[model samples]
Target: MGKLKSYQKQFQTLLDKGIDNAEIRHKRMVTRPFDFAEKLEKEAKSYSFKSVRQAHNQYAKSLYSSLRTLNERANGYAADLIARIDKEAAAAGAKSGNSKQPAKKTSTRRSTTAKKTASSQSSRGTASTSTASA
Candidate 1:
């Protein structure tokens, strides 16, 4: 269980780092180039590219950031679920261990006494019924 927790933490950390790296790469490779191109187009007074690349880049970055946050939240949820499962498994294991002992057998003498008592009670009931009928 401890190992599982450790692994979950490590995996979450890795995912966080991966998300950060991806954001950095996206800023460097996509947003920065689009910004530069938008500037160049504005300076050159070229209306040929009417695609609104800068606005698209901005929207894309906003969406990407949201996705990154959502991914991190998902990782957190997964970690919580793993922890919960581990706790339940440990509890079940403990219950099973305690219950795994062999059940105690009833003493033969006690069983014999119980049988005798039952027979006597039945005989008395029959005798009472006979007396009532009489």
Candidate 2:
């Protein structure tokens, strides 16, 4: 169980790092300054024609796809880990022996206290009668 917990924590850390990396890469790719020096060169015409906005969009799409893949992988890993943990727990429970049998049901015998109380109340006649509903 301890090992399983450790594995789960490690998986969570990996997922967190993946998310952070994706965010950092996305920010870096999208926020870069446009290169004005490339405009003067004839050979840079094809690349220069592509606007920063278009480049940013492309990078964003790529990042989104990669992040989605990462998330899917993480989900699969987490699921497998949970399943393994459950299997281990079930095996442990089985090994400890099935001593958890249902408790014996004792018969609920009615007591004669109600009858005794009623007889005593009757003997107290007038007091009991005075309190009775009309």
| TM-score of each model, paired residue for residue | 0.36, 0.38
Model 1 stretches with alpha carbons more than 4 Å out: 1-51, 98-134
Best model per TM-score: 2
Question: Native-vs-model 1 lDDT?
Answer: 0.81
Writing each residue's lDDT as its tens digit, candidate 2 over 27-81 gives 7876644344444464556565558568889999999999999999999999999
- Give a tens-digit lDDT track for model 1, residues 1-134: 99999999999999999999999988889987899898987876754345567767889999999999999999999999999999998899898885456555667666776666666766777545543333
Task: Identify the candidate with maximal lDDT.
Answer: 1
Clashing pairs in 2: none
* Model 2 regions lying over 4 Å from their true place: 1-50, 98-134
Model 2: which ten-residue window has the lowest total lDDT? 106-115
Q: State how far residue 57 of model 2 sits from its true place (Å).
A: 0.5
Give RMSD to native, each candidate. Answer: 23.2, 21.1
